[model samples]
Target: MKVGFDGKRATQNITGLGNYSRYLIRLLTKFHPHNQFLIYAITIPPPELAISEVEYRYPGKQLIKSYWRSFGIIKNLLRDNIDLFHGLSNEIPYSLKTAGIPTVVTIHDLIFIRYPQYYSFIDRLIYKYKYRYAALHADKVIAISKQTKQDLMHYFGVNEDKIEVIYQDCDVIFHQQVTSLMKDEIKKKYQLPEKYLLNVGTIEERKNLMLIAKALLRIDNIHLVVVGRETKYTLTVKQFIKQNQLSERVHFLHNVAHCDLPAIYQHAELLIYPSRFEGFGIPIVEALHSGIPVIAAKGSCLEEAGGPGSIYIDPDDDVELAKQVKGIIDNNETKMKMVRMGKQYLDNFKSKLISDQTIHLYQNVIDNAKR
Candidate 1:
């Protein structure tokens, strides 16, 4: 079988959607080497992802490059005789179904619909239209979490059977145990506190980094290490830190190298993720794989991502967040229990298992299309 991918994020983005795209390709090639794979992208893939088994194709003309995936990529798929096309992002070429190719689209989240206030008006409109079109037209729709699947049915009225829930795995680097020497070196390089809580994700309003900063007021000794791209929301968090005189207690490490992330996770006491919503929290999985306990927000798909073993606190409650942090820090037995449980929960998201399931879906779609 020949499979093609919408590789925009795969080639260009280093995080989130890009990681998913690259990891999927990596797993499929590792576990199902018999099939041919093609990556369609306007930009060249980064050096780190220059895999030999995959063929890369670009748009024919610069004029069409901006919207090639939605408009002009079908011709390329047909030219390559692609038996299956997977949109690793939330959209596929609008003409893919019309071209009679079996298509699958991975919808990461419907947060724009679920929390409209968090997104701009135009973004919400565009996402709704693109998501609805892909969900309606694709042969199969893959939702990253059960919450996302439910959002598809509720917001767009997509049929239940049309959506499949597939969880994503963290990078293999997180699964490796870092040596204490390497941990100390990375900690020294980053000037991380001797004991600190970690938070990984964008510094955006919806991520709710302020809650974690507020929690710091009630807790002592332990600092908070935040790593991610900063947005305007970051200023609000910084202002809160200044007003509360937490300059020394909260550290923001922006654009840290991906290779160094595991050491940071390995040396951390725990991960605190207070996001208001998520499709799936990859950081929680990374924490679990890194053998660290996680304290994440309650009342969303985080429970599904962090699993039952991880602690959950109300997103709005800073007092409760402080208490959980202190409790986990003071009680070694409880922290160890959470770590053990998290490790057990991570088995369900093993890369090979997810890859095989995705391959099965592709085969089913192809067979049904042929009939």
Candidate 2:
């Protein structure tokens, strides 16, 4: 099979959608080397990711480059004779269907629609247009979680049959064991507390990080280690931390190298993700893969990502959140049980399994297109 991907995020982004794109490409290439893979992007991809098994293509002229991703890229797809083009993000080129190519798009989340206050009016309008168009027009839609699939059906009225729920795995590095020495070194380098609760993701309102900060007021000596890109919402989190006099207990680490994350996870007491919504919570899987217990918010697909053994609490209830944290921290037996169950739950999200399922989906889409 000759497969092409919308490699903008894979090549340009270092996290989130970019991670997803790279993971899919790397796994498919590793497990299915016989198939040809093409990565299409407007910019030149990072040198390390331009592997021999995959070919990279981009626009040459300025005019074509300006509209390449949405309109101009169709000619390139046709010229390359791509058997199938998968948009790793939420959009496929509007012209792909007209050009007779089967398209598959991965819709990570419909958070902007579900929680409109987190996004500006213009952003919501743009997302709704692009996401709706791609979901409606693509030959198949891949929702990262069942919650996202339901959102697609509700907001865009996409048929349930059109959407496939394929769970995403965290970075393969998380699955590897980190040495105690490495964990110690990372803790020292980052100035992380000896015992801390870990939270990973962008510090945004939608992430509900302030809930954790508020919960910290009730707990003693246990710090919260936050790792992710910071935004304007971070200012709000910081203000709350200062107002509550939690300056000594909250640590924020930004742009930490990807190689260092497993050690950070290994050293932490547990993972607390209070995000109000997610397509699928990769951090939950990352923490689980590290054999740490997890406490995530109740309202989204986090349960699917965190699995059955993980604890879920209301996003707004800091008291209950604090109780859960203290319980996990104080009770060794419960902590160990959660860790064991988390490891078992992570089996379903193995890279090989996800890659195989994706391959099967590709074949099904291709075969159906032929008829």
Best by TM-score: 1
Clashing pairs in 2: none
| Model 1 residue 345 CA deviation in Å | 0.6
RMSD of each: 1.0, 1.2
| lDDT for each residue of candidate 2 in 59-142, tens digit (9 for 90 to 100) | 888576658888888889899999999999999888887788988999999999889998899999999999999999998999
Query: For residues 293-314, could you state the per-residue lDDT of candidate 1 as single tens digits?
Result: 9999987799999998998999
What lDDT does each candidate get? 0.92, 0.91
Instruction: Return model 2's CA RMSD, one decimal.
Output: 1.2
Best prediction by lDDT: 1
TM-score of each: 0.98, 0.97
Kindly give the number of clashing pairs for every candidate: 0, 0
